[model samples]
Target: MEKIIIIGAGLVGSLQALYLAKKGHTVEVYERRNDIRKQKLVAGRSINLALSNRGWKALKRVGINTVVEKTAIPMYGRIIHDTEGNTTYQPYGLEKEAIYSVSRGGLNQLLIEEADKLENVSFFFEHRCLDIDVESNTIIFENDTREIEVKGDRIFATDGAFSAIRARLQKRDRFNYQQFYLPHGYKELTIPAGENGSFLIEKNALHIWPRGNYMLIALGNNDGSFTCTLFFPFEGEYSFESLKTEDEIDNFFKNVFPDAYELIPNLSKEYQENPTASLVTVRCEPWNYEDKVLLMGDASHAIVPFYGQGMNSGFEDCSIFDDILEDNNLDFNKAIPEFAKTRKKDADAISELALRNFIEMRDLVADESFLLRKKIEKKIFEKHPNKWMPLYSQVTFSHIPYSEALNNGLKQEKIMDKIMAKPNIESLWDSQEVEDEILSLSANA
Candidate 1:
């Protein structure tokens, strides 16, 4: 078995180490932070992530789906709230099933513990990798209080955004990269469980309060509380920073999310306590440099959290990487480029789509015209079950390519416009035709 070094014992890296170790290889994981499982609460940085079918499938492949499912709260739809506290439930799927609400820290801890169970898997916490010697295939780490070098034939970087490994690879002219920061940023706040430890809203749906240019979203936790993320533009007259004072935050919450304020007794306090986090999308070409080293997860493609696929995509990356390796007769060198060439387009597509979805989530979902089209689209799906599926369905529920989903969505939108223009039965979509088109579109995908 080959020796492997994985940097960053975050969710993806931890999972990778477990999988590789199980496959009979020696695996060592180097993490910059303390062992997450030792902590009682998650770090107060990122909001909870939504894990859909994409993420579940990835975990299922490693025989941990049941464990993850136990921790996840099923979010069947978006419970939308208006300015006056009017509420509506927008179902994510036609069926009763929904996307999952799982804490990033909770999932990471679970994976980390699972990896530790592997006899061949070893972990080094508080080990920060400064750089890697590409030629020697060795990692230089500042472990706790001292610098140490570890030798390995292969290294997998899942070091997250602003990845040090990706930065070093750029110096070798091994790959092209781009990082784009959205004008908007997200700040997380909490609606802790009520005094009796009860959930304020239904525990089975994602809750949203969309206010024109901004949106407040909450995902349920197993502890009977909801974790909310407030997304707003970076520069504006009424930005996150602009609403500084307690009164300003109270007024903002009171005006836009009155229902939410009642559930969160100290809304203003929480807002002030939590720091605002920025959103960025990372794109890179050729995810690996020879079979000796490779990158995955946020280190390779970090998309905005709006689409709720950041972790799911990263997990899928591991699945795809494993497949390519198996296909190439377990030849690491041949597998790396094949992995890069095959995965680049899909990765790029998701990054773009994730950004595009921000507009739909924050603005368009609240628009009447957009809602009308969405309703009609749903109707089409009912009439033509096999042929008509929403773009969200394809992306979240199916393993369809990001590019194909966008193309089909655009096509459906055009056809929807034509149907709206005519308002006649003749203009109604033919279910079989729609099915054939979608099938054809995804056949090669």
Candidate 2:
């Protein structure tokens, strides 16, 4: 068995540890944060993530599917709430396959509990990784309670976006790292429960208020409330910083998002007090240093949350690594390098798509042209079920490669524009014409 050391104890880190342990490797997880289950974490934040098929497949790979599904709240459609407080339902899938909303902390703790049960797995909390010796496969950890060093044949750094290990490695190698900051920023707000503990919005659908150029999104919590994320620009004439006072925040919401203001009792107070988080897309090459060290999750590629694929993509990484390892007969020398080469394109593609979807979510969702295109696309899906699934479905509900999904979506959008102009869906779908247009692109891709 290989000796593997994993850094970080977040969702991605925990998944890597469990997967390595299940492969009969002696796994040790070093986390900088205190044990979450033993700590008092704040509530009413980005408490949950949108869990989809990719994440489910990853959870199932390590035998945690049942446990995760138990905690999941299925959301089959998106409930769009306009400025007037009217609701419209947009189904994610025609069938029962739906994305799930589950508490992020709850899922992490569950993974930790499951990993603790395995005799080969060990967890070290508050043990921050200070440095890594890639040549020697050694890790140094430090905290007030303990100063420790561990050596393993291989190290997996699933540490998060601001990864210390990744920073250290970049200094040594010719790593190309770039972080693109979106003009948009996000803040968390709460929609508390009713007196009898009932959800104010429909508990089953992901709720969104798609304001032009900015938007507000919320997912249901099992606690009969919603945790909403308000996305807005960082700096402008009427940006977050411009609205310096609580009254300004109130007035902004009262004018643009009156429905949300009605639901959130402490709207102004929350807006003034809560932090405005930046949205960034991070990209790096070679995701690994030598044959001894590798990085996964946000440590490698951190995309924006607009697509709701951040966690799902990370989970899909775990699945991809597992497949490569099993295919190559568990040889890290062959597996790690080959995995990087294949996944780099896919990762880069999703980062771009995630950024592009920001436009779709905030602006295009309300656009007549985009809506007409979508209607055309849906008609095509109805006829060519096997060949053409909506780009969203392929990305969220299936195991399709991100690159393929993005490219297909781009081509479909071009065709959709033509179909939209015609006003008759049948004209675009004359068997020979539609097949010729789509198949030509598919064959080339």
Predicted candidate 2 versus true structure: per-residue lDDT over 21-93, tens digit per residue: 8889999999998898785545556468999988999999888899888768899988887888887777887
Whose lDDT is greatest here?
2
Candidate 1: where is the Cα deviation over 4 Å? 42-46, 423-445
lDDT of 1 by residue, 1-445 (tens): 8999999999889988877887789999999998988988743334578998877887888899999888788888888888888888888877765899888888999999999998999999999999988889988899767999999978999899878898899887657878888878888887887667688788898888887688999988877778888898778877975888989988877877899888787677877887778998888877787778888889999999878988998888888888888898878788877887788787887887788888888888788767766776676666666777888888898888777877887777666665555444244444455435444543433
Of candidate 2, the 10-residue stretch with the lowest lDDT total is: 419-428
TM accuracy, model 1? 0.93
For candidate 1, list the clashing residue pairs, or say none: 387-435
User: Per-prediction TM-score, please?
Assistant: 0.93, 0.94
Q: Tell me, by TM-score, which candidate is best.
A: 2
Task: Report the number of clashing residue pairs per model.
Answer: 1, 0
Worst 10 residues of 1 by lDDT: 422-431
